[model samples]
Target: MTVKPADRDFDALFADPSTRARAARGVSIRLSGLTRRFGELEVLRGIDLDIAAGRFVAIVGRSGCGKSTLLRLLSGLDRPSGGELAFGAGEDDDVVPRLMFQEPRLLPWARVVDNVAVGLGRDRDAPDGRLRVASALAAVGLAEKAEAWPAVLSGGQKQRVALARALVSRPRFLALDEPLGALDALTRIGMQSLLERVWLAQGFTAVLVTHDVGEAIALADRVVMIEEGRVALDVAVDLPRPRRRGSAEAARLEAEILRHLVHEEPPDVGWVI
Candidate 1:
C-alpha cells in the first residue's frame, strides 16, 4: 500500500522516538450545531464543520465575523455554550493541541531555547526533552538562536522561535490565529513558507484564521470563509502547491471567496490582497 504523508512513519526524522509517536499523524474534527454566546452577543451561531485529518484548512472573514471565535472553540480554549464538538481518534489523538498567535509571546528575560522549552513545561527537565527541543528549533531554522534573547532577534526570527515553541510539544492539532499578521510583507511571505514547510514535514492537522485570502489559498488544502457567525464558503483548494500569486487558477479561487465576502450584510473591512 502507498503511504500517505500523514501515514508514513517519521521515526528517522526525530531523535526521540516518543516525540515522533507524540507527533500527530492526523486529526479529524466534527462540529454539530456549535454555538457560543457572550451575554446577548452570539459570536458563533450553530457552526457545523468537518475537517479531514492532516488537511491544511484556512478560515477567512471580516474582523468580527467569528473566525477567531471558531478557532478558540476548536483549540479547547473556549467551550461552546451549546451543541457538540467532537474529534475522531487518529494515530496520535491523545497529544494536546497547541495554538500560535500573531505575537511571538516570548519573554525578554528568557533565551530563545528556554522559551521553546516552556512549551514542554515539566518535560523540559527530562533527559530527552533537550534533544526534542533541538529538533524543533532546527525544523524552524532557529537552532543558532538557541541562546539569543527575544529582544535581540528580528520580528521574523522571533516568530520562528514561537513556531519552535509550539512545535516542541509535538502537538496533534495546530491552531494559528493570524500568526503572520504583524510581520512586514516580505517577512510575512517568508514566514508563510516556513510554516508550510514545517506543517508538511510534521503532518499535523492545521486550522489557520487569517484576513488575507491569498495567504489562505497559498497554504491551505481547503479554504473556509466565515460570515455572520457561520460558515459561508467551504471549498477545496484544487490548485497545486508552490502556486503562483497571480495565476489564473489562484485568482479564480480568490474571486470565489471574495464573492461571498462582498455579499455579506455589513460591508467587509477585510480586503483581498
Candidate 2:
C-alpha cells in the first residue's frame, strides 16, 4: 500500500483517543425519486442515490448535466421539486452541510483569521471561536498566515482559507463544487492531497462535483456520472488508497469513464469497475 501525505498527518492527529472521539462522523445521504425544476427546465429528472457515511463520492458529467444541481440539493442550497431527500443514521437537524466553491470567496477586508471565523456564524464571538478558527487554519497548514490578508495569499492559499472556513464549522457533510478547479495543475494536485487528509481526519461525508473523470477516480470511493439529468453510470473504485494518477488501473478507469462522457461506443466498455 502506498502511503499518502494524509496518512502521516492522520496518524499524528488522531493518536489521542479523546481527540479522535471528538471528530465528526459522516452523515449518510439518501435521495429517492428526487426531481428539480426551474420553470420549464428540469435539471434533475429523478435521482436515486444512497451515499454511505464517511464515503467520498464524486459526481461527474458534461456541462449542464445537473452535476452541480445535484450537489446543491445535497448541500441543502436548493430543494427538490419532487421526491424525497433525507440524511440518515448518526445525523440530526443540527448537522449543517458545508459547501466549498470554485472561487475562494473570502472577504477582502477581513484578515485570514476573521475570514475563517465567519464560518461560525452567530458563534464567532463565542469564547472558543478564536481557538476553533486557529485550529481550522492549522489543519489546512495555514497557521502562519492567520494574521495575513486574503489579498496577500496565493490562489492555492486562498482556497486553503476557504477550506478552513468550511471545516471550522465541523460539518458532517461537505459538498465540493469544483473547489480546486481554479488552481494551477501542481497546486490542484497538492490541494487534492490536503483535502483527502482533512476528510480522513474529520471523517466527513464528501460529495465532489467535477468535470474531470481522472480526478473523480483518484479521490472518490465511487464515481457517479450524470447524464440527461439521471445517473447513467455508477462505479466503485476498488483500487488501494493513495491512488496513483498515472498508474495502469487509474488510466483504465479514466478511459472507461471518458467513453461514457463522450458517448463513445467502445465494444468492450462496461461499468463493472
Candidate 3:
C-alpha cells in the first residue's frame, strides 16, 4: 500500500522494539521516560527532549553516550526499546527527510548524480526526481561533478555529495551524525559554513551529534550535553550566524561549554572535557 503524504489517509502506529508501524507526524518530538540497554550495558536512561519546529539543536557527549543510537532511533534506522519518538507535520508537508552520516556513502559504480538520487524517485526523467538531484547538487556547489564518479572525489567532496543526497528530499528534519568529523580541521570549517548556509535557506529542523564542543557551539543554536545516558546540560548560543571560532567571545563560550561537558558531568557527556 502506498502512503500518501497527508493526514486523514494516514494513522500512526507505535510498536515497542520490534514491530513496524506508520511513523508519527508534526514537529513535536517526545521521548518520554526512555531507556536503552545493550545486553548488560545501559546506554540511555530517562531522556526527555521536546524540540519545537524550526529549531536547530546539537547533542554533544563523550564516546559511548548513545548519541549515535539516539540519532538512529530518530532517523528510523533503529527501534527504541522503551521510549517513543514522534514528530509533528504541518499542512502540505514537504519531502521526507534523509539522514547524512560520517561516511558519504555514494555508490562507487554510479555517477555523482545517480548516487545522490539513490533513494529518490525511481525514474531519472521524473520532474521531481531530476529537479531534486540537480538542486541538491547545486546547493552544495557540486553541479559540475554531476557526471563524476565517487572514487574520483576527495574526502571533503565525497562528504559534500553525501550532504547533497540528504538534502535532495528537502527533509524537514536534518539529522547530522558526525558527518564532518572525518574531515581535516580546515575542511571541517568550510563544510560547516556550507551547512549553515543550507540550513538558513531551507529552514529545516536540524539535530547534530558532535564530539567537538567547538563544532557544537559554532554550528548549533542550542547545544545539549548528554551525560550518563541523559541530557545533562542544554546551552543556547546567543551569538548570531557566521560565528568565528577564533573570536575571544566565541572562544570563551566554547571553553565554558567544554568545561561543563567534562568535569561537571558523568561518563555520558561530561566524561571528556
Predicted structure with the largest lDDT when compared to the true one: 2
For candidate 3, lDDT tens digit of each residue in 1-273? 111232121111111122121122214455776777788888888789887665678899888888988888777787777876667743454435568898888889999999889856344566778777876777777778999999999899899999888877656688899999889878888888778767665667788999988888888888988888998888888887767667777788788888776674564644432
The lDDT values for all models are 0.81, 0.83, 0.74
Error of 3 at 170 (Å): 0.6
Clashes of each: 0, 0, 8
Q: Residue 141 deviation, candidate 1, in Å?
A: 1.2
Worst 10 residues of 3 by lDDT: 7-16
Window of ten residues with lowest summed lDDT in model 1 = 1-10
**In candidate 2, residue 19 scores what lDDT?**
37
TM-score of 1: 0.87
- lDDT against true structure, model 1: 0.81
Ranking by lDDT: 2, 1, 3
Candidate 1: stretches off by over 4 Å: 1-24, 90-92, 242-244, 264-273
- By the TM-score metric, which is better: model 1 or model 3? 1
Please report the candidate that would top TM-score against the real structure: 2
Give me the runs in candidate 3 sitting further than 4 Å from their true place: 1-26, 89-95, 119-125, 264-273
